[model samples]
Target chain A: GAGVSQSPSNKVTEKGKDVELRCDPISGHTALYWYRQRLGQGLEFLIYFQGNSAPDKSGLPSDRFSAERTGESVSTLTIQRTQQEDSAVYLCASSLVTRDIQYFGAGTRLSVL
Target chain B: AQSVAQPEDQVNVAEGNPLTVKCTYSVSGNPYLFWYVQYPNRGLQFLLKYITGDNLVKGSYGFEAEFNKSQTSFHLKKPSALVSDSALYFCAVRDADSGTYKYIFGTGTRLKVLA
Candidate 1:
């Protein structure tokens, strides 16, 4: 793809339901990142992947949030038993390297009712 | 811990006037600074970054930022504000010596250019 791509531009789920958000990074990008942006707030880092390995998972808000990447391509963020606080925009970004400038996706707006 | 701060929640400027969005940072080592802009219903767009070399870095859409080591600041500046330039601006920083790729972002500053 020309740029980072995220699926399901918008989502509305019940408070106890599970939701999956997907991201397809630009071709050949080795570094991928996930972030959360609450309404009227800046981005909060969630996780980072170098290839298929996630070196940092310290930013995940809780045990209910988890993510995985496959072969350095598409990645999925899964939230189990979602809560009302989970309502936010989930963003994905990709970079050629860890220190390079990142290109971001439009993001998935998740609304947990 | 590395962190960034954007003090102003919002800044209003008249069109064609100079505008600035302030940012300050704290890190254990030398910093790599970045500025990004977010328009409504869209993702963030990279404006500029200050990794090294010259302190004055020019970026897309006539945006520029200056990295001041002494002041621990990287303020975004535009000589002439445009109505289209109204958006949310964010400042981010990474600690070069922290050995981690995580970037700390400040709360965004909203810029509103009045015509």
Candidate 2:
């Protein structure tokens, strides 16, 4: 795709359930980022991947949150034992390189019931 | 640590009038500033960025932002507003010299342009 794409535009799951959100970054983009935007709040950075380097996971809220990306293409964010506080729009973005302008996806809105 | 502050929770402007959304940021070194807009039920759309050279940066949808280093601020602006311009605005910053390559964003400001 020409732009970043995310799957399951909306997702609803019960608390304590596991959910997976997928992202397909712009072709050839080397930097990928994941962010969570809670209702009425700003974006909270979750993770960053720059090519084959070790991902920067400092912003991840908890151990239950994890992400994996394969060869600068598809990435998946997994939330285990989701909590009410975990509800938010999960946004995915990709850039041509680290520190460059980022292009964002439509985002996957997750609702934890 | 880097951070952004959007002073106003909301700003109301009439169509055809000039609009300004305030944003301030704090960073250790030179800052790479950016502005993004979010429409209802949509993700962020990049508007403009201030890296170096020009303090006034132009972006998509006829939007622009001025970076003030002394003030530590990057305020988004538009010459004339439109009803369609109503949306949420966010300001972000990253330390260009920090080497960490992380961007910190503000809480966001909602802009309502009435026709």
Candidate 3:
């Protein structure tokens, strides 16, 4: 795809269940990012992957939150034992390693009941 | 720690009037500032960025931002606001000289243009 692609435009899951959100970054981009936007709030950084370097997981909220990306392709964000507070739009973005601007996906809206 | 702040939760502007959305930041090193717009139920679209050199940076949709080093601010401006220009605006900042590449974003400002 020409732009970053995210799967499951909307997801509804019960509290305590697990969920996985996927993102397909633009081809040849070496940087990928994940963020969470709760209702009426700004984006909160989650994780960052740059090339073959170790992903910076400093922004992840908890141990239950984890992400994996293989060789700059598809990435998945997993949330275990979801809580109501976890309900938010999960956003994915990709950019060239040297570029400061990021192109974002439409985002996956996760609703935790 | 690096952070960004948008003082106004919402800004209302009349159609064809000049509009400004305020943003400020605190970073440990040189700052790379950017503005993004989010329409209803859509992803963020990059509007502009201030990386280096020019303080007044032009962006998409006829928008621009001025970077002030002394004040540590980057305010988005449009010469004339259109009804369709109304959307949620975000300001983000990253420490350019730092090894970490994560960007910190402001809470966001909702712009409403009345015709």
Candidate 4:
């Protein structure tokens, strides 16, 4: 793809429902990252995946938040039993390699009602 | 742990005036700093980065940032502010010594350029 792409630009889900956000990174980018941004707040790192090594999941806020990337292509971030506090913009970014500049997607705005 | 701080929540500047958005960082050893700008309803756009060499690094849209190791700051600057330059700016830092690829971002500062 020409640039990083995210699906379901906006999502409205009821509390306790599960929601999945998808990210299609730029072609050939081996590094993928997920972030969350609440209104009037800075971006919070959620997870990072680099080339098939063990993903750095330290940023995941809670056990209900999980993510997976298959073969450096598409990635999905899933929030189980979403809480109202989980309403925020979920962003995805990709880079050619670690420590390189990252390209970001438009992000999916999730609203837990 | 690496962290970035953007002390100002908002900065208002008149068009054609020089503008600056302050940023400071904390990290072990040297720091890899970055600046990104975000427009309404849009993804973040990379503005610039400082890795090594010169202390001043230039980036897209006539924007530049200076890396000060002693002060632990990477302030973004522009000679002239444009009305279109109004957006949210973010500063980020990564630990150079730890080899950790993750970047810690600062709370964003909103820039408003009045025409």
Which candidate leads in lDDT? 3
Using TM-score as the yardstick, the better of models 1 and 2 is 1
Q: Rank the candidates by lDDT, best first.
A: 3, 4, 1, 2
What residue pairs are clashing in model 1?
A: none
Could you give me the TM-score of model 3 versus the true structure? 0.98
Lowest summed lDDT across 10 adjacent residues in model 2 chain A is found at A94-103
lDDT of 4 by residue, A1-113 (tens): 38999999999999999999999999999999999999899999999998889999999999999999999899999999999999999999999865479899999999999
Candidate 3 per-residue lDDT, tens place, A1-113, comes to 58999989999999999999999999999999999999999999999999999999999999999999999899999999999999999999999858778999999999999
After superposition, which runs of candidate 4 have C-alpha atoms over 4 Å from their true positions? Answer: none
What's model 4's lDDT at B66?
A: 91
DockQ of 4: 0.90
Q: Scoring only the second chain, what is candidate 1's TM-score?
A: 0.98
Cα error of candidate 4 at position B10, Å: 0.4
Query: Where is model 3 more than 4 Å wrong at Cα?
Result: none
Which pairs of residues collide in candidate 4?
none
Q: Tens digits of per-residue lDDT for model 2 on A1-113?
A: 47899999999999999999999999999999999999899989999998899999999999999999999899999999999999899999999754478899999999999
The Cα local distance difference test for each model comes to: 0.92, 0.92, 0.96, 0.94
- Scanning candidate 2 chain B in windows of ten residues, the lowest lDDT window is B96-105
| Model 4, span B1-115: residue lDDT tens | 7889999999999999999999999997778899999998789989999999999999999999999888999999999999999999999988878766788899999999999
Ranking by TM-score: 3, 4, 1, 2
Whole-structure CA lDDT of model 2: 0.92
Report how far residue A63 has shifted in candidate 2, in Å. 0.5
- Give the C-alpha miss distance for residue B112 in model 1, angstroms: 0.3
- Residue ranges of candidate 2 with Cα displaced over 4 Å: none
lDDT of 4 at B29: 74
lDDT of 2 by residue, B1-115 (tens): 9989999999999999999999999888999999999999777888888989999999999999898888998999999999999999999998888876778889999999998
